[model samples]
Target: MGIFQPLNTPIRDWQGQRVWIVGASSGIGAALARALAARGAWVALSARRREALEEVASACKGETRVEPMDATRPEDFERVRERLLAAWGRLDLVVFNAGTYQPLRAAELTPAVVRGILDTNLLGVMDGVAACVPLFTRQGRGAMALVGSVAGYGGLPKATVYGPGKAALINFAETLYLDLAPVGVSVFLVSPGFVATPLTAQNDFAMPALMSPDAAAEAMLAGFARGDFEIHFPRRFTLVLKLLRFLPRRFYFALIHRLTGL
Candidate 1:
């Protein structure tokens, strides 16, 4: 009915869908898992903390499987994949929501912080893709959703390390979409402005247009129903960020510095 009609065939029904979420221990991932399960999807939860995963899984409606694993580790991804295939036989969707973040300014830049952010945010997403691609290829149908950020749209103050990681992920998702969509697989890059979560709890400044994790989950599901490739939320904030991406480099830098006082 629109430009987005049938991007990868709208997922109108959730019943019996085998969905795996890699960062379901908390925040958006946990909320999404709960929402999908309520709609009759069998959700498999994964995270480094088994206790946290269990806590989320226990609240889910349908059969919820807990598969704890460190997203940054290749062995962990492989192990989780093997177990998922064995349990579900086939996966309908894989949401790569596992990520780490820290307020990193130029003055506070450190090698360890950069490495940790990149490993978890960028490389970790690649690991998920690597593990799931083979299975999806075999089945000839599946979907992958990556959690990027509005910060990735432009360079922001105090986002020295985190912004680059998300930027890389956004670019990676675009490339993956072009490569995988022809083969009957779907790729979605999700960008949320600021959601109230453990990850953003450390922020000192007020988060404009902050939303609850449940709201974020609802927006994601709405995006899936429309079969859109880029799932962004809180139009009041993300829309501005999207517009800024079109400004000239010099003007963009000046405006950002003036706005953020960086």
Candidate 2:
């Protein structure tokens, strides 16, 4: 890759594109499905909720397939990958949007909760990557998107387990890109700001720069069209987090404590 080269291929046309989106039962995942389908893309929706995925599929235009699979189960991801490959013969893009977030103080963390977050957020994405990379290698082309969070950019008061899980994803996505990009594959990391969804409904803090899921979906598509490696949105919020990443640990901790009062 050249110094000024785009990190990935810019996907300007969605018409007839085949996109498999995991965790598409609701929220940004569902919205992205609808947006892509509207643009004439064939969308395969997967989530743990069979009925919910079906409901989402009903509203999506164009050809749609629904698969219910638990993210924590690697076998489930493999099975869905096989089904989608058999059905479409080629998957242009695969987006892993499934994640969980629970606000917890450090003391409130437990073994079960820690493992649960790691399994669903970090390991789940790794498993999905493993399932898709071989097929992508065989085809010599395919794109992947991993939906991370601003929480992953730095340590926070209430993000304890959830923050670490997402932080791992940030690392994982970068590593995947290094290994996969040379094979003619594109890997994107999506770190969204506060979005009004069932997931954000769990956050008690006054969320700054919160955007709608529909808006988030739009931002994501725009990022793909631009071939951006890191598609972070609501820049008013995310840019600040990005800048804070370079802060010294002591000052960073002080600022976070002062802002969050945790």
Candidate with best TM-score: 2
Per-model TM-score on C-alpha atoms: 0.97, 0.98
lDDT of 1 by residue, 1-262 (tens): 3564666656879999999999999999999999999999999999999999999989999889999999889889889888988988889999999988898779898898889889999999998899999889889999999999998999999999999899998999999988999899999999998999999998988788999999999999999998888999998899999899899999999999888777
Residue clash pairs of candidate 1: none
Cand. 1 Cα-lDDT: 0.92
> Which 10 successive residues of model 2 have the least lDDT summed?
1-10
Model 2 C-alpha lDDT per residue in residues 32-77, reported as the tens digit of each score: 9999999999999998999999999999998999989999999998
RMSD of 1: 1.4
Runs with alpha carbons beyond 4 Å of true place in candidate 2 = none
Question: Each model's C-alpha lDDT?
Answer: 0.92, 0.92
Please report how far candidate 2 places residue 38 from its true position, in Å: 0.4
